[model samples]
Target: MNRRIGILISGRGSNMMALVERADGYDVALVASDKPDAPGLAWAKSRGIATFALSPKGIGKAGYEAQIDAALREAGVEIIALAGYMRLLSDDFVARWRGRIVNIHPSLLPRYKGLDTHARAIAAGDAVAGCSVHVVTEELDGGAVLGQAEVPIEPGDTPEILAARVLAAEHALYPRVLKEFVANERPNPA
Candidate 1:
């Protein structure tokens, strides 16, 4: 059986779109966001996928994630994919869903753990910059990497330019990685 996947996003969810375009071994059972006006929810709805959106402000992080947890459970989601979900999940959330949640980071892991990854790469004069797919752990961006795709950083390339390139890499890399991940995780059913 295909994995029942739940995708979480906060913005346009371009990566989520990429995953949807190639959802073969997985079912996108739910598309959810913390921002009620998030564009991705509309896009998901257009694709006939279930969606949930709610405001997190003043709800507290744990409370907000509890709501998300409820949605995921209701949808029978077997896997959680973070496309552009900006909020940090509580430690309890990560632990409950350990090894079942994954995220795509704009930069290679163990470096640029936080935001401004593109600018950080360029400012450091790094010759190569890329993206990584990793297990989501309680420690921010501290998960073990599952896959990576690299692109050379051209001289004087602005963060915007680099970001665009990295995003393209993300679009291509995430779906393939997720497919393989799900397959590897399938049970023997012995």
Candidate 2:
């Protein structure tokens, strides 16, 4: 069966666009955001993908996640992809989806779990930087890694340059891992 995917985004959604472009044998059922004016929404809509925006600014985290759950269910989304999504999901929400959710974090992961990873790595004098595609768990980026790709941390590289390289890896890794997941037919992680 073709997987039905719902993508959540906050900003430009470069990774989201990569998925959309390569979504063969998969249905992009929905594109959702917490920002009403996310550029990704416009891009998805132009391609005729269903879109939604649920702001948590006033609704609180649990309430917002509930709305997202409802929206995903309504759209029959079988896979949830966090592509530049900024919010940390609630534990309950993570439990509900389990291994059905995936995120591409711009770090080696289990190393730089939170933000500013590039700057931190550069400052720490790391020779390599990378990104990870992992199953989303309640424990931040602590989930099982599905795949990763590394990029050399050239001397004097800025965070922006490092981020670009990581993003390139993400665009390649996410679609490949998603395809592998469907092909292997592995049971969703609990």
How many angstroms is residue 117 displaced in model 1 relative to the true structure, after the best TM-score fit? 0.6
lDDT of 2 by residue, 31-149 (tens): 99999899999999999999999899888998899999999989988788899999899989988997788899988888899899999889989999999989899898999898888
Best by lDDT: 1
RMSD over all Cα atoms, model 1: 2.2
What lDDT tens digits, residue by residue, belong to model 1 across residues 1-190?
8988999999999999999998879989999999999998999999999999988889888788889999998998888999999988989998888888999999988889989999999999899999999999999999989999998999879999999999999999999999988888753211
How accurate locally is residue 96 in candidate 2, as Cα lDDT from 0 to 100? 93
Worst 10-residue stretch by lDDT in candidate 2? 181-190
How far is 177's C-alpha from truth in model 1 (Å)?
0.5
Best by TM-score: 1
lDDT, candidate 2, at 145? 91
